[model samples]
Target chain A: MSFKPDHEIYRRRFSRNLGVGLCLVAFVMLGFFLTVEKVTRGNPLDALQGKPYVAAPVAP
Target chain B: MTDIQAQATPAEPGFGDFVQLLKPRVMSLVVFTALVGLMVAPVHLYPVAGFSAILFIALGAGASGALNMWWDADIDAVMRRTRNRPVPSGRIQPCEALGLGVALSGISVVMLALATNLMAAGLLAFTIFFYAVVYSMWLKRLTPQNIVIGGAAGAFPPMIGWVAATGSMSLEACLMFALIFMWTPPHFWALALFMKEDYSNAGVPMLTVTHGRRATRVHVLVYTLLLVPFAMALGWMSIGGPVYIAAAAVLNVWFVVGAVRIWRRDEVQAEADKYAVEKAFFRFSLVYLFAHFSALLVEAVLRAQVYGV
Candidate 1:
């Protein structure tokens, strides 16, 4: 049996799948940035290296 | 000839249907007020943090919207205004909305804690619970003063934003909360005056349905009168500036005049005018909120730019 590329089901489901896919991608990016912000600002790694993690003074 | 294709196609839910489950218009208000709240706080947040904080709060608000749809599906189906919502119209399953609300509520609260602070997260969690359970399930069906109390749920975002930024509460944040809380009654009562039939048909005890339109109109004026002090006080607070005070003065005058007009009209006169005054008041209430918040935001920007606060 041959599969049709433009089936009705495919057309119906495409947008929903694409939206969920985009949201997941965006969430991953948000997580990456959040981690980077936390680590860079406080230098949490300093604590792991036997040093205190002093929070950087935040800008107004 | 194409028997398989001729079979009736079940109505399939789409992305937009799911988004509708989130009540995007309400989410817009949530996003705007929360942004203003975050901006006006004394401490500045890193751009990414600020964005994430607002996004999570919006998500929490949207999650509650979904839960409200789930709970209110019956009343929603009866009400003309909400009859076509995703769940009530059968595009999305009630269980799906429930699951989405629960999952997003958990995710938003946890992510907010991670992105901002525990206080902000706690407030978001409480807000979701207040909206979904206390307001939607209990207060909405039980009392004419439903939105009056339920307005607290919508009033929370700015306080959450403030807490997210300052990691604590202040009078400024409370003032912003009070402004929205006070504004909600008149805003909704105006809508209720026009949409009385929907609330009556849905068996919801809106003030217009229970206390008569005349009483609802009086309540609108009284609430509008009460709301003015909160708005003016916020203007005089540290966050308030010349811009905000001026805006508040003008907006309050217009708002009070609108409320008084609403109060003075009898149903016969209102019907003669096709409820024009009520509809105008409803539209202006949206502007009243947006302008007030915008003024606060403008003051924050000016302070940051000029005084470098």
Candidate 2:
């Protein structure tokens, strides 16, 4: 198969691909941060370590 | 090869078109109001969890928007305002929009459950269902009171935000919900007054179409009058302060005055003046909601500073 010159379709497809890629990356980052925050702030890690999980103090 | 390429090539949609299907403008309102709801709650949310909660809420809102566009593509094609939307304009396929909406809806709801509490997630799920199925598919085409009931879907975000923070509901949250719920009818009716032809042509039964323009005008005034109490009541809540109350008092007076002007005008006066009052009211309605929420946010900050919550 022979390759043709770059077409308008390729350009549009590239934009879509790039956008989807960025969104996926953002989602992964958000998930990572959320997990970190959950483990650090709460007693999730303590429970994981077989310690009695003390509930974090919540505001009224 | 050239012929094959020619046959395959159509107006392929860009990234922005997909974004448009999400109704970014509506999502912006959802984000802002939800943020206010989260911030004003007495409970403290870890920064990351708070951010994730808002993001999932926004995504859920965006998913509903995509579903609305997919379902309403036919009517959207007829309406001047919505004619150029992604699905209607054929830039994006209807099925693609539907798939995106469904996927995003599921993802957002599940992710929200992980990031926040089940209560918030449940509310988010219900909001998406209400907007995509109940409001978009049923109420919109069936009745003139569509936006009235449909407005609840929009009003849910703030309450969901509060729930995400506190894992429960509160009077303050309900007050926030009521504020948007009451404001929606007047805000949309003001738009209906000017965009009367769009709804009628699209075969969507808006108040301006079923009832007369005069009736819509009256409804706008009536709803605006009703909205004032809810707006004022929020000021007395824990989230509220002197700042919110003063802002609410001034904004409500201005809003009611605008609604009254809209009510007093007839088609002749409206047409002669190019629907300036109606148009102005529509614009101000956006500011009205934003300012009210901003006032609540300011009050929340002040309370935090004074009492160290």
- In DockQ terms, which candidate is top? 2
lDDT (Cα, 0-100) at B104 in candidate 1: 98
For model 2, report DockQ: 0.55
Query: RMSD, model 2, all Cα superposed?
Result: 4.1
Docking band of candidate 1 = acceptable
Quality of model 1 by C-alpha lDDT: 0.94
Q: Provide DockQ values for all models, in the order shown.
A: 0.43, 0.55
Give the per-residue lDDT digits (tens) of candidate 2, residues B4-110.
43464587888999999999999999999999999999897988899999999999999999999999999999999999999999999999999999999999999
What tens digits encode model 1's per-residue C-alpha lDDT throughout B273-296?
A: 999999999999999999999999
Candidate 1: regions farther than 4 A off: A1-9, A42-60, B1-8
